[model samples]
Target: MSPHHEPPLTRLAWIGMAGLALVLVAMSPVAGQVAANVAVPEPDGYRMENYRAPTPASLRGAQVVDTAQAHRLWNDKAAVFVDVMPRDVKPPNLPAGTIWRDKKREDVPGSVWLPNVGYGVLNAEMDSYFRRGLAGITEGRKDAPLVFYCKTDCWMSWNAAKRAMEYGYANITWYPGGSDGWAEAGLPLEVAKPVE
Candidate 1:
């Protein structure tokens, strides 16, 4: 007899479940009643951002990858796997009794966690920092293969991949299947260090 180890459901299964949930919601009697019967709340100006990985033709020039591609790069030691997740930022002027909770970072195996390199805003200081950090990792080789990732639906990896391309890294890959995707694929992860 063998123990049953359940990895995250396959992507298709997850998508199917999500679609079913939506259908169920739309069919609910009270919720699906006519618009005039329900009181709508005022809009809060909050909108969700699309974080899904772009299609091949929509990814600009960066190569989008799945778990298989991530594995191939990692196993071959053919690329520098960089985790571009940003550290949590705490706002100033918090209430005196406030306590900020921190989330632990468990990045993909063999990844160099480099925070701040993937900020959406492109600036001189950040650019310099990323360039210097990348130079140290790639030994100043502009053509070094670089794989960037963080978490699923995370824009950090996308931003980092673009930055790497701008810096002349000839081999660049955007692992849209980030840490969560890696886990869902039944791959192991490790506690990430704060610095590279």
Candidate 2:
């Protein structure tokens, strides 16, 4: 071998060392954190069951906001904050002429409450209600910034946000923490009524 030339085994060892370094970097804690923060893969369809469980970390075509971000949007009035918590309905089996009273619901102040519109499968009536509610809030502007929420660990907001995306609403946000988070943060809430 010449004075400046290296043996084939030495060059191969150097390449192996470089590959090992790359693997170590990839397995580092910082790298693991980065990987953890990556968006969770979206499900193929709406979450049909277990509505009150931990939801996915992300939704395709929607910005996922935290409690603070949601507050900023509400305080600035930059987006339409929507609460999708379902409302209890009167039982049809009740005696004739029985007076029915709805359970009171408190939500983020100034939020539009669209009850029962967040189900994975909405009937024709609920579908129309959701569509019209969005139209009314955005005044037919498909690009309006809309924030959706329900309760912490609830998947209804996720489904609703996805449905809004399907409806061609250009700007959509999903606040996974929802009202529970807001209240837990000592934020104020007000009684809400479903849109007629």
Candidate 3:
């Protein structure tokens, strides 16, 4: 065979090796990190869908805390932890006099549970509720340290933290690990009730 006339099998083997190289590069840790960023890109506004999906690692204008930091804040009474988990509403279309049961939620020992206030958009009532709840907890002091959380990998906490910042709160902490992490760390939790 001439110098330029390679065997067909040799050509096929070269193509396969190139393909494998591309696949390995795509599967690298750096590629995985890039993919994760693309999958969970931060939104200009609140997250409107898939509230339970993986969330961004950071929130602008807020500090993201882990389980241990959250516990320290709780112990020092340095922050008022807010649980933004949504409460299940009784179906209005159910038969009249139907008994509806509500699920019980447990959160950090002293965290305030503010149900239904973490959605992307809030009605006047919920907006007012969230505003008033924050004011009540912080005693109208916008600079009071406030920690917000829901569940692990949940965006509700992120939305709530951002909302608090929008409301002119000066000190805000986002506890991404949330109650799940707290429980996993062997911390105590208490039955929670939404702020009225």
Candidate 4:
């Protein structure tokens, strides 16, 4: 037998070691939660800031308005209608005084065209542009209600709404029922001519 001797660990030492291990394990979950919560926007798309997760309750009666309501809002020009539709869909069908992105010429009537395309599609640049685009639509007016939509179950509008909230926009609404919803209503479609 070797004559080497070792000091026995005291109870405090065992407790200290156990506490450190517990802390590390506990912290792992928090770190993961933070990473998951900070969901980065898609590539070449708009990134979100100060984002908060949306629950069904918060969106309750929060103007997840239908096609008719959207039309009424459009006629009154009471809200800035944003279309984040991907390229390839037919141009937006805007009612009188309604604004939307012109798929043909990269513009929308009284609305800004921010197509779901290009570099950093969801990066800071796109996010910044969305902020400015929304600003222009509202003309620096916060009270102006903002409505957003895309294709049915499309995530772009949803993302846009979340980002808008992050930007401290109030009275913001998302029409999950998008172009499909509008078409279902048999609303007259206004097609914009292609740009030369």
* lDDT tens per residue, model 3, 1-196: 8747999899899899999999999999999989766756677799987899899888999998889899999999999999999999888899988999889999999889998888999999999999999999999999999999999989899999999999999899999999999999999999998887
Candidate 2 weakest lDDT stretch, 10 residues:
35-44
The lDDT of model 2 is: 0.91
- Candidate 3: give the clashing pairs: none
TM-score winner among the candidates? 3
Candidate 3 structure lDDT: 0.92
Against the true structure, candidate 1 has what lDDT? Answer: 0.74
Cα deviation at 161, candidate 4, in Å, is 1.0
Question: Top lDDT: which candidate number?
Answer: 3
Error of 3 at 91 (Å): 2.5
Write the residue-wise lDDT of candidate 2 on 53-134 in tens digits.
7688889889999999999999999999999998887787999988899988999999999988888999999999999999
- Say which prediction, candidate 2 or candidate 4, comes out ahead on lDDT: 2
The models' CA-based lDDT, in order, is 0.74, 0.91, 0.92, 0.59
**TM-score of decoy 2:** 0.78
RMSD of every candidate to native, in Å, equals 15.6, 9.3, 3.5, 13.9
In angstroms, give how far residue 115 of model 4 lies from its true place. Answer: 1.8
